[model samples]
Target: MSANRYPLEVDVAIVGSGPTSAAYARILSELAPEARIAMFEVGPSISNPPGAHVKNIGDPAARAAAQRASEGPGAGAATVNSPGEVKAGTRQARPGTFLLTEGYAADGEDGLPVAAMSSNVGGMGAHWTGACPRPGGAERIGFLDDLDALLAEAERLLGVTTQAFEQAPLPQKVRELLAAQVDQDRVAEYRVQPMPLAVHRRPEGQLVWSGADVVMGEATRNNENFTLFDNSLVRRVLTDGAAASGVELSDQLTGQQYQVAARCVVVGADALRTPQLLWASGIRPEALGRYLNDQAQVVFASRLRGVEASQGAGAPGAGLSEQSGVSWVPYTDEEPFHGQIMQLDASPVPLADDDPVVPGSIVGLGLFCAKDLSAQDRVEFDDQVPDFYGMPSMRIHYRLSEADHQVIERAKQQIVRLGHAVGDPLDERPFVMPPGSSLHYQGTTRMGTADDGTSVCSPDSEVWQVPGLFVAGNGVIPTATACNPTLTSVALAVRGARRIAEKLNNSLLMSKSDNRMSE
Candidate 1:
């Protein structure tokens, strides 16, 4: 189908539909009750998670079988996406495994990194482990205290359930093992308990908790002002002169081009896709696609012999209880959000790909997230590789710094100490890698005041180059804090949506006043 000839108008246009899109849409609806919004997603609705991302169809019925057997709702959502029968080169290739784009070959000498984006109603949130953490300390520079109010609003709109965690049906041993990480000195060192998440926990059950699926459906979907368009991939911004006026999109399912004009545009494509969208639209700034950050991850695996197989929603092992200048969860400081400590409740066998080895035994994964490397790396559009839609695909060029390595090394030592605290038998060795070797990549279109020339958005997350355009998600984050970026992304979206509504409301009131004066 051809492009919509007349301007398809709305009060706001949200580019992506992850947690950011849903949360912001709620805020906009409340603040501007009469305002119309256009929410576009390049994937299917929540009803069919598999159809949303083609990769979820791996082995055809494999995912469905797994989901039926597993406690997690959508555990079996991926379908292997490789050509033919899963050959050596195609084993890991699955439809929702990573974001896919059809566009130009990247500009880098080595070419762009594999760029994967979630194509679902909830976008990446659908595949997420439901980790929700707010940025603290240095990471709070770009965002103001007004963010707290926004966060509260997000919690309500997103239906975040705190009581959910208390109810997870976890195994007894799993609970003890995770809680043990916070004994005495360990608590003193970290100064916090396990990080609170957005997942719904079944407090009285066997310790099992579903992720964020509880509040996302039906309830929030009831808003009449909130409209969602699935299977619609955004192509580029429709601009007037240099300012963004709206967006041009292609309905992936039907091969149709459409446009949604808004007085304001909000880009919430997360860290990976947000930068490329800005660049594709000619929104330039020193930091548009620079300072690419990711957490460096290392894992230590072993098995607890006496522990029975995991049956319930396992408590996230001390899950997110520790933080330092270089590390947050199982990742380190060198790569910013790179290091993450994953305490997976599972058995261990020798396997490869990404993940560190403990050298012996089976149990759980003690992931080490390293520090953030404040290096200048980035994502941009490759002029050569074009997708079926003919838009430029993203090209990413990134690496870690020496500071990142030291953080990982220190993390290994801490992992050993943590093992001791939990009284678990563990191998004292750790696997290693180059900084940024593990992807949790973020921070391309950072937000800051005008004084910080590297930033593309203001403190309020408004794009400097395009006044009406705002950015939410990891792309606009000034720093990659030790926590997962989703909660903060939602918070920022709420904040930005309020700003958009206020501006539009003021504009309408002024226009009406002028009309009356003219009469």
Candidate 2:
């Protein structure tokens, strides 16, 4: 649709076209096919043919060029270079190409920076590694009811499977060798299995998953009522008294401001921006941006000594191949950290016959420990210094607690032990990734059983102060889960969408009844 054809109002207006909003839009559209839905995205709509810039994931130069070409002229550069700017760095993945245009703030105390939230249409889902593990009982939020059903539905929607590379020889042998070193009690407790991934095998047996775009792209494309406004940055939720009336949006290309009147609004703008929008609109609950939490990750890389060069052949870039699989060590009561072991196909070493060991066969182990939700670790909006979108830039204040530090220490010891058991350890010690580098930020707009000032939203993900406003994303997850929070967050969004659908349906019925009475 052309920019002139964009609707002035919608029954449902969703901010942020990430996984959470995509899931909500999918479910709600199915429930009410006749309803008008508008999804606003701050980044370019590059997923479509004209702007398909994500062609090469392995080639950094190609990816960067593609991203730059997609942005066109006048788009600002990415504010963050790497997670290291905020003291957070990732060993497995490099800085994203599309994230170059996004903005983030640095902390004054430790100088650790928060992960740059993607302003693109797909949000962070486009750049994620596709690891989708369900949170265990210990990791689930205590107040979230119907957890089992929600997870099941979420799994179905994500097409999660645990057999992506189950038949791989190297990963199997590594797991077996590692299990032999640990006692049966500990082995059973940890329960290492094939990592659950949101991917599917093609007819030629290649694994692929195109994030939320694949999940709901067809639905949005087919449904004319569902409209997408890309390169539209949402400034704030326009509220009338205690109720949300619409949203103020800015065209990133033209720098034109517009209002999108909505009967109901859902904000899935990630952890930082979600609260920033709320705070910008003067909806400052005490816990609006407090209780921020992200998994504390520790990463270690090792080379598999004595492995034949031929055996490590065909490993795809960014690690997993037909011959190698990824393993997950779920969080247990005894060990409160989630662990993963995967082959790094993007290792810097070259594969050659002369070398004693196979090059590019570096296996990486990652430990993600759940951090306690604390008010002290939060995001502050600096309205004085506006970003390119003319909104307040964020300043993150995050510090690892004593418990988090202890978990990292324990995880380091375990990584060393496993390294010796699997292969020759390369680095002197494992590197502790900076906080927020995990890209699993949660608990900012947490849902609670009550509307107390401590919680930003109710159990149904409805804002306590706003009747027709809702929130969906990782920020709504109240628990500090060690596992990847994407699936859990999507599950919560599904639940919220159902509630919103029911409310909208009931309102429609009431309007008809009132019209009949007036006649």
Which number leads on lDDT?
2
* TM-score of every prediction relative to native: 0.74, 0.87
- State residue 473's C-alpha deviation in candidate 2, in Å: 1.4
Q: Give the per-residue lDDT of model 2 (tens digit) for 39-119.
A: 988887655521121532456675554445343222344534432332333322233322213233343543234354555
Q: What is the Å distance of residue 159 in model 1 from its true position?
A: 3.8
Superposed model 2: Cα runs more than 4 Å off: 1-5, 48-62, 66-93, 97-108, 181-183, 186-190, 203-205, 315-320, 346-360, 512-519
Candidate lDDT values, in order: 0.53, 0.71
TM-score of 1: 0.74
The regions of model 1 sitting more than 4 angstroms off are 1-7, 46-95, 99-115, 161-192, 201-220, 304-363, 366-372, 423-439, 511-519
Error of 1 at 77 (Å): 13
Model 2 lowest lDDT segment of ten: 346-355
Cα RMSD of predicted structure 1:
7.4
